[model samples]
Target: MRLKSALSKVFASFVVKGIEKWKFDAVAAQERTLKKLVNEASHTVFGVDHRFVEIKNYEDFKARVPVRDYEDLKPYIERVVAGEADILWKDKPEYLAKTSGTTSGVKYIPISKQSMPEHIKAARNALLTYIHETGNASFVDGKLIFLQGSPVLAKKNGINVGRLSGIVAHLVPAYLQKNRMPSYQTNCIEDWEQKVDAIVEETINEDMRLISGIPPWVQMYFDKLTEKSGGKQIKDIFKNFQLFVYGGVNFEPYRAKIEASIGKKIAAIETYPASEGFIAYQDSQTEKGLLLLADAGMFYEFIPSEEYYNEKPTRLSLAEVELDKNYALILNTNAGLWGYSIGDTIKFISLNPYKIVVTGRIKHFISAFGEHVIGEEVEHALLSVANEEGIEITEFTVAPQVNPTFGELPYHEWFVEFVKAPVDLSAFALKVDKALQLKNIYYFDLIEGNILRSLKITILQKDAFVNYMKSEGKLGGQNKVPRLSNDRKLAEGLERYIA
Candidate 1:
């Protein structure tokens, strides 16, 4: 334990120094990263097509290559999948991360040997930075559990294919494996519930000091742990558990319930990692936003969210981004993704250190009645209502319900699965409706003009969202409920389980 603690301290010190140096000249660091990435891939098809050899700076690169989404890159990706080399990067990717697609069945994102360091190193640094910031080196002495996807990877044209978490799992350092719980066999369980059961059986009595996963799944694990431990809270079972490192979904809604389940407040660390790359992580205990990794093997571009859907949106380089504006993130990475849209939106909170808060997804919003409401707004409104009403929401989704018959006005329908139901359901609905109106002026106008009727709140049965996710074969890992949808597909699909 002493040796491990000493080693963790040394590593944490190194990471902190590295982060400080990187942030010392954030703009210069990003410019250097872009240059290196472009120069390395200069001979590739994409690089050559985009005049990479002549591209000496950010402006040149942007002028040469258009911003692309998954669909735009599909042709190049498909060619690579078919055994072609030097399509996007200098060589074919060693792995392909399959993600739940936004507009399609699935998205296969390339992952190269060169790109692996950014994902792995950034994640390691995030944890180490947290340890350094909080002086929690003892966390290294005890077991740390990462509730992730199966480690069993599939192959596609000789390339490993699986969830990014699963791929990263297979790459866990040998030293850390000693303190990591629930062996590979348990992690490889295909069924999420079965895997959670196996994990609980294996680590219920272990010296667990750290836990990492999406908030919803972690909450599920805590629930199971509490049930099996004769109703004992997680803190009672794992007395040493001190930190929760989570990503994939906003942790705000789950915070209250998760804290209650643990029976105490534990330090939490948040990360922003996507199939595209590991972008940022919470670097300060005092700050409320994540610090963008300027030296990570990716160059970032930001398009203002409001202007992104315009015919031609302005793209800003890292140095040009303004504070507190919602920007659609674009990436040009060593992994071979060039000028790619990751679909997530973020608002810069700090300029000197480049800190940001993820606002929402680009496509995840409702504007059916020209009352545009993004995921961030919906979440904020719901959170406000939850706090005021003294309720705990397990999960929720909202959709616009356009009346099929004449003489009926369209309205927003909210499906909420609560951990603790409010005393007055109608009053809770009224609060949420009023909160939404306050958040979006267009929504208020629609309500006032009778273009949209009052919001309807349907309290879902327990685990309705879970059941919905299970039905969709996405009950675990990185899958999450879209807070708001422009159409009725998700809302109608979840309606069946409404209480």
Candidate 2:
């Protein structure tokens, strides 16, 4: 083996051993993490304001700090952006991750020097865990590509401000710099389509081994490569490709299409990373959940997702979580985020080691007529039916159509772009509708009571989602269409692309 490859194996082994230290005692790890975070930030502006110094335990911490979203936390973040030090953390943030928000417009999330490494470490551990499990470290010898935003950052009061992926671009370890692609100049291109073209141009003939990105963007790259190569599949162009690492959206809905594009199956790792913190990662290839990062520099809290909008919801510590219950994740981190809701929903699948699966987004749900429908339900409904029927879809989204044509009852509208159309579209729609009913009791009750009609599927033209995202200026880099929406905005916008 080459020197770098040998070193990678050694490092992967070391990391896995470190993981074992706290993997079994996750509850204690989280307690230690919370205590450390609170004690370290006790003298900071937010800490002082929230009485962090007086917090002795989780109950005390919760009593002092209320869970807040980006809008609620904007004032403190604004102060940080204006050159205020120790407002949210112990000192000035090392960088600000800029992201678009629905209600708040643009949002800035701080990343402290102490907390940034946790993000890098969790990602590294995910890969190293794979190596330790399968003894496959040969990919380190080949080229790797991560589809992400530009690394070029703008300044916000002396703080480097950019997308989280872009900021992460500057932190690729020295040992892997030579193996990473597309060139910094190519990645810096703001136009996503042009950047993909440049990436394809640069990577087409290389010994590419690992591809990482949000699945949709990677699919776009594969499409370009296939088109440019006169219909040759991705595997033909890059035979050494062995792993697909993705996050930001559930992969099951896109699995068939992605595998078809690649012309074969490959191992994949899913990570749960957010602007607030790196939360969880797939620790075992055979396991269904991501291991929650209990020992990371962040403390966690959970609110039952159903009660999230209640005046006062039940908040649970790691020790209090139950299996298979969906909760809105909250964070208190070394980065100075205290009781911050990141807007994502997750369900604990394992308690002993604290493993979780991303269920959906707190805001991305369709409760238009009292029948709440979440992302997990919609995805399970669609993918279960599609997989059963062997139908392949390129992309899809769901929205409530409260006002239908003439006297028709309100119904869920599915906008789907299919690679393989079903033999009977109406039958396919009914199957998905029934599948969803089985998953959500409220939806089932609504349908049975005639409060809502069966879901409807609207066939979309090729690249309809791509066009919609481009029109909205969210073409790539961690941007994904919400799987469920409560209103008709997305449905109305998608009307133009009806096939």
Candidate 3:
């Protein structure tokens, strides 16, 4: 334990130094990284098309390469999938990270040898930063369980393909693998239920010091652990458990429930990692935002949320962003994704050291009646109502109910799964409606003008989301229910599960 503590201190110090160096002069660091990326990919097809050689500065680069979404780059990505070389990056990608799509059936994101190291480095730094901030280095001495997807990868066009989490699992450092839980054999089980069971059976008695995963799924793991250990809380089952690392989804809704399940307070670390690149991580224990990884192998652009849907949105670089404004994120990465829009929206909360909070998604919103309600508004409203009403909700989704066949005017329909159901369902719905109106001016106007009917709420049966994701073959890792949609696709699909 003494030796482990000493090593952890050394690791923490090293990470602090690295972070300091990267953040020394944020603008300068980003400029250097951008220059390096442009120079490295200058020989690629994309670079040639965009006239990379003539680009002398950020303005030149922006003027040449227009921002693009996954659909916009589909043609180029298709060529890469067909084993084409030097199309987007200098060389073909080493692997493709597959993510679920809303419009497209699936998205294949390239992961090059150069970018893989960036992902690994960012993850390591996130943990080490946590240790440095909290002085909790003892976690390294014990097991750390990460609820990841199956590591079994598939081949596509002779390139490896799989979920990002699964890919990262295969790349775990050799030394840390000794302290990682849920043996490789267990992680390979594709079925989430069986995998969780195997994990519980294997690690119930182990010296678990840390756990990491999406909050909802991690909550599921905690539930299973408690059940298997005869109703003891997770903290009782794993006495040394110290940290809970989460990413991929908003952790606010699940925070209270998870804390209750654990029966003790544990430090939580939040990260913002997309298949495109590792973006940010919670760097300070007291601060409420994630510090942007400015020098990672990616260049970033932000289009103000208000202008995001415009034909030609104004793109701002890191040095141009303002504090507390939502912006759609765009990226140029070493992994062959250039000027790519990842669809997520974020707001800068601090600028000196550069920190942000992910607000919502560009494609995930309800504007059918010009209410223009985004995921951020819905999440805020839900959390506000949940707190005010003393209710605990596990999962939820909102969609428009617009068909006249139902003999009612159009309204927003909500499907909610509650861990602690509200005593007065009608009052709960009313409270949520009022909260939404408060959050969105257009929504309020629509309701006041009687253009849209009152919102409708439907309680979902237990594990409704889990079952829905299971039916879609996306049961566990990184999959989440979209909070708001302009149409009824998701809501209608989940109708059968409504209680």
Candidate 4:
């Protein structure tokens, strides 16, 4: 392992001063292209673009190409599988970003040749954020920070045999400084142990000011940092490491405790990215609230929560979204996932366009005995239960678990890491169960307990959830503790109690 002596640390601190600063800067062409993407997103369907040049205007485009869900594109994707790439757009796909789904094996999502630039742009934006927050830029010249995401691989047939991380890793800008760590591609993910080992060694002795990756992986990095340093805490170890960046899903459950363990309120950035594109980012000032990259190579639309389930959702174009409204995000990217619903639920936070907060996944819900619960409902119930119990829940995950006696019913197991464990589990369960009942009056009576007593709470010590992830081999990279379990197979995989 590379070791950073105290002098090396001081010298590295001097090096940090020369790194270049990144501002949220772009050229006029970038802005024009972004606007075009948004406009195209607002107007098209089934591989056609500039569909409403005949419509002659923006509002007419909105009236024609309503926001759509993934299922709506099933036909187009099927056509792609049949060797027709033009069903959605004109580009022949450079590659497909494979995303797993419960109903399907793996969706070979066609991301266009043009999508690579957005990845670099999002990265620069994230880097810019670090410079602004830390006041450190080429602003100094130490080892460049590396985002430890997944790696890429090439097959005998010349097709990439790895994830999106692998593909993007191959596309790293040659212009960046050499002080940076290995690209996700070169890290060689297929050899997991070796990949992790290399990252651990590099992180221990290097000057890494900004680290970007999935939250679980970053957490694992800190844990490994401690282990590599012969049990020194991360706070004592990564003294020069200023900010830890993350994206994908909610960091709410782990935020307070992770910060506590890091021994400082580490500046945290939550981003909204997908296989389709880096759709948005959380501002340095906003924290959890994300700002849509409205000017990126994508057109965006938001359909009201009520209309999300309808065959035709009422669409709000990028120029039309409002504050505090629950909307399902729809996208039209340069990659050609036109009118695509990423299936995330975000609430608009500001009206000038692009300011939003990702509230939760569209399907991240718990029914508590077939009540058809949603994320908002779960958050509400959790808060109600916490308030009633005079406690605060720091970590929790809700899923459907089966009990033979109760048959197949959705259960919200409150695995809480609290400030203090509450005395009354029954009352806490009752409080949550009651709020759920407000959503579905039939649930209480449907269950024998007359209050859906299946709901339960288990208090945990801080770091318990992180420890669980470590044991599960899901501690790092592009994995999350699956938030909703529609069926037992995947649900069983995330159920830590059984193991």
Q: Cα lDDT of all candidates, in order?
A: 0.89, 0.92, 0.88, 0.61
What is the lDDT, from 0 to 100, of the residue 112 in candidate 1? 93
For model 3, the stretches where C-alpha displacement exceeds 4 angstroms are: 404-407
Whose TM-score is higher: candidate 3's or candidate 4's? 3
Per-prediction RMSD in angstroms?
A: 1.4, 0.8, 1.5, 6.8
lDDT digits (tens) for residues 1-499 of candidate 2: 8888888889999999999999999989999999899899899889899998899999999899999998898899899999899899977999999999989998899999998999999988999999889888889899999999999999988999999999999999888899999999999999999999999999999999999999999999999999999999989999999999999999988899999999999999999888888999999988789999999898899999989999889999998999999999998888998889999999988887889999999999999988878999999999999998899989999998888898999899999999978989999999999999999999999999999999999999999999999999999998998888888889888999999
TM-scores of the candidates are 0.97, 0.99, 0.97, 0.76
Candidate 2 ranges beyond 4 A from true positions: none
Best by TM-score: 2
Predicted structure 3, TM vs. truth: 0.97
Query: Which tens-of-lDDT digit does each residue in 345-416 have in candidate 3?
Result: 999988888899998888899999888898888888888989877788888999987774657878898899
- Pairing residues by index, what is the TM-score of model 1? 0.97
lDDT of 1: 0.89
Better lDDT candidate (2, 3): 2
Residue 115's lDDT within candidate 2 is 86
Q: Candidate 4 local accuracy as lDDT?
A: 0.61
List clash counts for every candidate, in order. 0, 0, 0, 18
- Give lDDT for model 2: 0.92
Winner by lDDT between candidate 4 and candidate 2: 2
Give the Å error, residue 159, model 2. Answer: 0.8
